[model samples]
Target: MQLARIHHLLQVAILLAVMVLSIWLIGDVLMVVFAATLIAVILHNLAAMVERRTRLPYWLALSLVVVVLLAAIGGLGWSSGPAIAEQATRLRIALTTQAHSLRGQLNASTMGRTVLDYLPQSLGGNQAGGGDNGMGSRIAGSMTGVLSSAFGAAGTLAVILIAGLYFALSPALYVNGLLRLIPPGHRPAARTLLLVAGRTLWAWTAGQALDMLVVGILSGVGLWFIGVPLALALGVVAGMANFIPYIGAFIGAVPAILLGLSQGTREGLLVMALYAAIQFFEGNVMAPLIQRHAVQMPPGLTILSQTVFGTILGLPGLVLASPLTAALLAMMDRATPPLDEEDRV
Candidate 1:
């Protein structure tokens, strides 16, 4: 019996190793597919409600929901395109100017001169043919190659959309299939777990959407009032970044400050103050209210999970961390039974 148990342990370990390797190997596609599925799940309840209330066919309701979603995406993209383009142009110009100024300042200082002497050697590899420019070109080429490889999987977007539609349209079937894996006595409990997860996910999504809108509008308005160029674009970036929890606010601030600095020191200071206020409001007031209404995650656990998953999965990990954490909590709640009748009540 001991030998048999040891064999089972070894088998489990090998299986887990394989799973980890598979996840790492296909991390990019998996992230997009998971994101699509979660979005579909959030919209599932709305589609079902519309179908029932309007006495429309399931397919028709599904189509309506898809149309509305596509329209919203298109509208936002169309409206934001020009602002984003302008901001991109301005940001590039600002960064170039800053780099040149910094280089000049460095050249004037003894320490800077010493550092500059080593910079070219540090940047260039030992290859005789590869100078600094060649190294930079190679690095850029490698980045392009990596991006192309990551996105080159044929019809990936289509697959995600179709999978999302199917899941949204017939979530019950999926739930039933999952519940079938449980023991007979636990199937009901499994169903309850699914419901809890769905509710939590929906709540989290709603809160996130509201937070994004509020931040975006505030950032845009603040930038406009401060006379910062590319205010609209910066606002959009801030709003989008706000979805990622802790690190996002800082990332959004960098570009805003850079743009502000381009205007002058005074404008940069104003932008900094405005951004700080926005971060304060978001962290203290907005987050708590949203959490009360939606899924409540422990702040410490949220940060920890974000770090772990982000390390393994990159940007997508940060974006999906909260929802994934909520799902895990739901599972835990289901696994642990109530203490007593009083607790149940």
Candidate 2:
């Protein structure tokens, strides 16, 4: 029996090593798959709602959900793609011009010139904006690479949607298969834990979606009122970046600040103030309201998890850190014993 136990331990170790190796080798692909799984969960919840409302079969409800989602995306793209592209073009020009202007400002004094000398050429010091520098030509040269990257992104998105469809349509199949891996005595407990985790994730996802929507709308309106150029594009960036928590707000704000600087120092300061106000509203009002219905993680834990995951897995890991942390917490709660009233005191 001891020899058998040792053999089992060795087998488990080998399997663990192989799993780690495989994950490292295909981290990007795995991230895409993980993202698809999250999407699938969200879609599944939507399908369940449709099923309840329409009294449709499970499969039919799932299909309807998928179709509607795809239609909405396609329609949005068809209608807004050109406007977004146009705004993005303006954004690039604004950024380039602002960079050149900053370079000139920095070259005005000895200290400024020293700073400029240390700064990278890509940021447009004396090296750029020269007659032979050809900013326009450099941008043109990069268009092919941009197009290729766009194509790659589109292909990855396609895979995500297709995989999401399968997972959303037959979530039970996958869930049941996974449950089968558990020991018979623990299967019931495992099922219960899964249910708890699912509910937590669903709540978190729904709340996050609402938060993103509110932030996007508020940002666009605020920036527009402040007379910021590319308000729509900037708002979208802000909304998307909000997914990463504390660090995200600053990341989203940088572009807006630079664009404001293009106009003047006063405008730049105003833009900075506007973003700070927006973040204040989001943190105090929006997040607390959402947390009432969703899991509320400690700010420190969220930050720590993001830092660790970001170090290990880069941006994709950082983006997923919160949700993954939530899921782990949910399962851990299930595994832990609840304290009695005396213990609590």
Question: lDDT per residue, candidate 2, 25-106, as tens digits?
Answer: 5555666777788888898899899999999998899889878978998998899978888898888888878777777787
User: Model 2 off-target regions past 4 Å?
Assistant: 1-26, 103-151, 339-345
Model 1 steric clash pairs:
none
Instruction: Tell me the spans in candidate 1 whose CA falls farther than 4 Å from its real position.
Output: 1-22, 78-80, 96-150, 153-158, 181-186, 337-345
Q: What is the TM-score of each candidate against the true structure?
A: 0.76, 0.80
RMSD after CA superposition, every candidate: 6.1, 7.0
TM-score of 1: 0.76
Q: Candidate 1's residue-wise lDDT over 252-320, tens digit each?
A: 888889778878999999999999999899889998999888877887998898886676666566778
Which RMSD does model 1 reach against the true structure?
6.1
- Residue pair clashes in candidate 2: none
